[model samples]
Target: MDTKLIIIETTTDDKEMANKLSHLLIKEKLAGCVQVNQINSYYEYDDKINNTVEYLIRIKTLSNYYEDVKEFLSKEHNFELPEFISYECKEVSKDYLDWIVKNLNK
Candidate 1:
């Protein structure tokens, strides 16, 4: 199985959403770990040229699970245009990578 790290963004800055998603991912054995952080302004959308707060969730999972993870995100996400992005890991610390594989198995 290939390991992948996904970055998902939401419209609202509610920490609760991040927490819930993280728990769901782990509980369902779809992701190893999820870290949510408050980030500065990135871009404007919907004619709103202003600064806003946002949370970035970093999820660790296998490549094959992206579709399932995306589905779960889409169904639970409140934003109409939530960001669904993924990054392939070419190299990672052995210990960390092993942790991901272990936690992501049901």
Candidate 2:
């Protein structure tokens, strides 16, 4: 039995955002893992160089607990509208997904 996983990509590239997100997710037992990556993308917002650093957070958890997870993020996130997107994992090996389930409760 595994949880439906998702990614929460934030606009900020700051390590602080990554760390806080990971800590909060795990602390609440809503996710097993939140892998963060530094990504660079170019954008045009307000005619400004919106080239920014962003974090790609891969979250793992039980499929049934998604609502609680969403609630927590909605209340805790600092941004007015944080990037919280959940994608269905089309394919996953049992071993890897099981590992994610195990590490989340640690």
Model 2: per-residue Cα lDDT over 1-106, one tens digit each = 4455554444445678778977988887778777777888687868887777677666767666677777877787666777777766767778877776776666
Query: Against the true structure, whose TM-score is highest?
Result: 1
Worst 10 residues of 1 by lDDT: 3-12
lDDT of 2 at 72: 78
Q: Write model 1 residue lDDT over 11-36, tens digit each, in one string.
A: 44677888888888889987887888
User: What TM-scores do the predictions have?
Assistant: 0.84, 0.74
The models' CA-based lDDT, in order, is 0.76, 0.70
- lDDT for model 2 comes to 0.70
Residue 62, candidate 1: C-alpha displacement in angstroms: 0.9
CA shift of 19, model 2, Å: 0.3
Kindly report which residue pairs in candidate 2 clash with one another. 3-61, 3-62, 3-63, 4-63, 32-104
At residue 15, candidate 1 shows an lDDT of: 79
